[model samples]
Target: MKTEFTDIAVIGGGPAGLAAALEAKRAGVKRVVVLERDVELGGILRQCIHDGFGIHRFKKRMSGNEYAQAFIDETEKSDIKAYADTTALELTADRKIYACNSRDGMLEIRAGAVIMTTGCRERTASQALIYGERPAGALTAGAVQRYINIDGYLPGKRAVVLGSGDIGLIMARRMTLEGIEVEGVYEVMSSPGGLTRNIVQCLDDYGIPLHLSATVTKIEGRDRVRAVTVAKTDGSRRPIAGTERVVECDLLVLAVGLIPENELLIKAGAEIDPRTKGAVLNDRFETSLSGIFAAGNAAAVFDLVDYVSVSGEIAARGAVEFLRENTSDKNTENASGGADGYVPVIAGENINFVIPQRVRKGAARDLAFFMRVKTSAPRAELRCLCDGAVAEKKVCRYIAPPEMLSMTPCCAAEREIKIDAVNE
Candidate 1:
């Protein structure tokens, strides 16, 4: 066993972890380290060769690998230390981390603060409940992506995608580019789950059909996927009895959903949010556990990678503030406690959920709230209420679940804040 100490220890080396580690180091943290389970610093980005990333942050379209490379380059130039091929096995509420790798058999790290950016995992065939045989060709869109993009091998010739998520849409186009026939994309919801831009570029431009309010109820084949039975669904998303159709294909690619990787956070005694399936966090991105913060997909799945990076930076700033306050005996104001006051931020009407479910008053001059809508709205009014009074209001031309809404409002001296969205 090896013992180490640092000001901050970040788990996971994906975009969120990379960005958080870099930001923490830049924020004057004496010692910062990032632990990545993968062999390389870049996580899933290495497999995402398609362009469309960095549109918000870099102001130019770049490939996922290129976007991750930019951050990797910055991290390498900074004072931050990153350990690749290291898996974080345990995290404690007191900012202790247990991790291991082949090179470092076991590591026990004690840090002033800890940041979790473990990212997310895609929903698989069994999880999605696609009743069928466990065939070799049945794989998630992300798996197929890794197979084709990273490993440079085609998984199948003909495929039937069971979800209309961004990854699925992108893979639909990717498979098409590779001369693989994408029979069609089916979504249980009436509306597409991905961004409109992806629907246009990946499906519309490629002449691929998108079946809405439909799903793959069953898969067939013993050795390899031979076909899938897709059916139209009712309002409850249950497949209708007489609307079943068989689509013959070698591969069944599932793009159903993503689940945040928060086992370590849970082990660390952090409160989990039921809606987001992440962590219940304060305005400073600090989790329920003291000195532990979560960001990016580990906090909640963001529609854009740019937003993921933003969350990481926020968590980094929070960690820096925490370390600065605790390191000095003179700074006795415990920001994690109720000395500054905390206001619960409730999600109301048309909003699925909001990050930073609670806000610590005086933590920041301006607090940013990120949320996703439950349904599409052509015109809507967003309101941030403090103590039943409208603190901020904004009118939007359109809002959808696929695009996360970010609003930064000046902090008010109120103890309660509620964010609401309604069709106008």
Candidate 2:
């Protein structure tokens, strides 16, 4: 196989990968390459034509496609190399990436440091367990977005969206504008999984029927999705027998959840985080493999694309620092291992998953953490206790499973924070 080497290799062409490559180049990494599988550089954003993306990061409201274009346009003003219509089929335990393209057919690329920003995949109807016919009209919400926005085809005349995820809610409003009827949105949880602003603007303002504490139990159809059966749920989320009803529709879009794509990182022998289902990295975002770094969705499921972009830039900075320091002597293990240093894995009452399982107490490294809550927290104080001392503390507006909370170290130390709760 033909092989080449670069300063850095970014695995995705989405916002995260784009931002990472851009930052790497800006940080003076002369040879930066981004391998994207799609013909376009925008990734899924090209199909997400709906407006609402870019609020915090860009400080301006823009559509997903528009934001994607903005990033593409900016890259043109820089020296980032983007390989469109390319795929990395295999990755070795080291940093060797086996990739293929139309022109090259098959090839390999080695880099001094690798950055994983492969993004995520949407959960489908089958995963949702909504008993349904295998029909043409059953599509994931992201697929529906692609059909309408990119393929120039409307999915259906009438629809019923399952799950109150951000994508599902956005589609509810988009369908209305396209003159399609949205029967209802069924969510198993009492509260929505999307941002609070989305629930207000997309559902409440549009008079869209949002059935909380309920879910679509089954779907009925022959060749196309014709109708769906929904049932009310109690606190336990078990369906109430008599609350079932058949709602007619031509399309069923699933927006249940998104799983991070971490195949490459996992293949590189990186420690995986059980909660995030991504690579386990330290404060600087360097994975168990010293030369291999990760950011964006490959690190965790981020709420907004802006956060993904921010994560990519940070990861790029670390990659640049690694090159400048000329530190390439250590193995992927001792250079990055910290799992044994944790005294004990502690989870505060009501706290969700705490990442970093452990931190090295010495060598003076920055400690960062990712966490969420078991349930909705009106107002909970997030505190970390290490060695019977309050190592770090921060107040949270609300903590829920849908949101991933990140905290950087207040002081430079590899101390593990024993997470716990405090009064509002």
**lDDT for each candidate structure:** 0.89, 0.79
Clash pairs (backbone) in predicted model 1: none
**lDDT for 58 (candidate 2):** 83
lDDT of 2 at 198: 82
Q: Residue-wise lDDT of candidate 2 within 1-424, one digit each (tens)?
A: 7888888988888888888889888888999888999997987888878777888788998988988998899877787778899999877767788999998889799988888888888887778877757877888888888878777788899999998988889988888787778888889988887777888888888889888999888889989988888899999988999999999999987889889888877776788878788887655567777667788887888767787787888778878876765556644332434556433436777766665455544554455666666777777788877666776788987776777676665443444457765648
Candidate 1 lDDT, tens digit per residue, 258-314? 999899999778899999999999877999988899999989999688989999999
Cα RMSD of all models vs. native, in order, equals: 1.7, 2.8
TM-score, candidate 1, is 0.96
Q: Lowest summed lDDT over 10 consecutive residues: which window, candidate 1?
A: 331-340
Strongest candidate by lDDT: 1
lDDT score of residue 178 within candidate 1: 99
Which candidate number maximizes TM-score? 1
- TM-score of every candidate relative to the true structure: 0.96, 0.90
